[model samples]
Target: MALKRKKAYESNIEKINGARMTIETQMMAIENANVNLETMGAMRAGAEAMKNIHGSMNIDKVDETMDDIRDQMDIANEISEAISRPVGVGDDLDEDELLNELEELEQEELDAKMLETPSPVVTAPNVPVHVPAARANEVEDDEEAELRALQASMAM
Candidate 1:
């Protein structure tokens, strides 16, 4: 009697395992169907939107509008180029003449400044009054200071 009861329990376990496998397979099928329905809905919505857009558009009018835009853009570019070009910048003109005149003016100003600088006065004995060494921060002239600096550097 105990051996028969053990065999019955073993058969019941096998049947339960088969039922669990069937339920798992059914769940997988339901999940796949849900994914397929969502994909089809999305595809249908996209198709409907595209159909509405196509119904509203005329291809010939679109082409004409694009051509007009391109023509306007071309005209605008031409106008921009014309406006940006420098006026009177002819190949016959010498641009260096203006630079040369500026340089000459600078040289003239330098000469005038040099002529304006006063020379130190000398007494009848021709003795030079010396500046104190401690008060020697005053520059007599930039050219003389530069000359002394050059000489000192060359000596070194």
Candidate 2:
């Protein structure tokens, strides 16, 4: 009787395990279906956006706008070049004559400055000035004494 009861319990455990495996499989299938539905929804939204964008703009209009922008840029570049060009490039002026004229103008300015009257000078008050004593006589005396002392020391 004990052996029959043990066999029955083993059989029940096996059945329960099989049912758990089936439930897990069904759950995984439901999750996969949900992911598939979300992916389809995102794809549909992207398609609608693309259709709206295409409907708003034509290829010819885009090309014409780009061409106009390019033409404006070229015109701007030409105007810039014209403005930056050096002035007097085609003039026929003599460099020697210009230099002589500049020298004459400078000489005329110097002559005019020299002919102007000088400013009046300011005179100081009369006062007795104190003069410093001469140090040359002291230096001569020191040199003579130093030579005599050095000669005497050397002789000793």
Candidate 3:
């Protein structure tokens, strides 16, 4: 009876482990699907932007926009590939490595975006700018006059 009980217990453990693996695989599949959908969305947006540019719109900004879309596609591709591979399938395929690569890709995309958007040159305001010494002298004269008046009032 004890032998039968032990066999049943071991079988249940195996079943639980199998279920866990299946769940993990399904989650990965869902993640891949989401990434693909996002890629499609990015591609659609890029196409629409291109169409607008073709319709006589000044599309100087379209290059950067397209590059951004391309970056998104790259990310989607990376994610899909990562998820499609079975977990722990390769010696170099750890979760940390995958996450680090994704982070690096994201940072690269940010850097590209920063490079694409030119900073607006801020010109100084045209207001009458006075030298600081001149302003300070004016303030000092006012303070002296105020002090003299106070002294005179106290004397009275």
TM-score of 1: 0.50
| Model 3 ranges off by over 4 Å | 57-156
Write down the worst ten-residue block by lDDT for model 1: 133-142
Per-residue lDDT for 10-124 in model 1, tens only? 9999999999999999999999999999999999999999999988789998999999999999999999988887886664667798789899999999999999999999667
Candidate 3 or 2, higher lDDT: 3
Which residue ranges in model 1 land beyond 4 Å of their true spot? 86-156
Across 15-52, the per-residue lDDT of candidate 3 in tens digits comes to 99999999999999999999999999999999999899
For candidate 3, report its TM-score. 0.35
* For model 2, the run of ten residues with the poorest summed lDDT: 128-137
Off by over 4 Å in 2: 88-156
**Highest lDDT scorer:** 3
Clashing pairs in 3: none
Clashes of each: 0, 0, 0
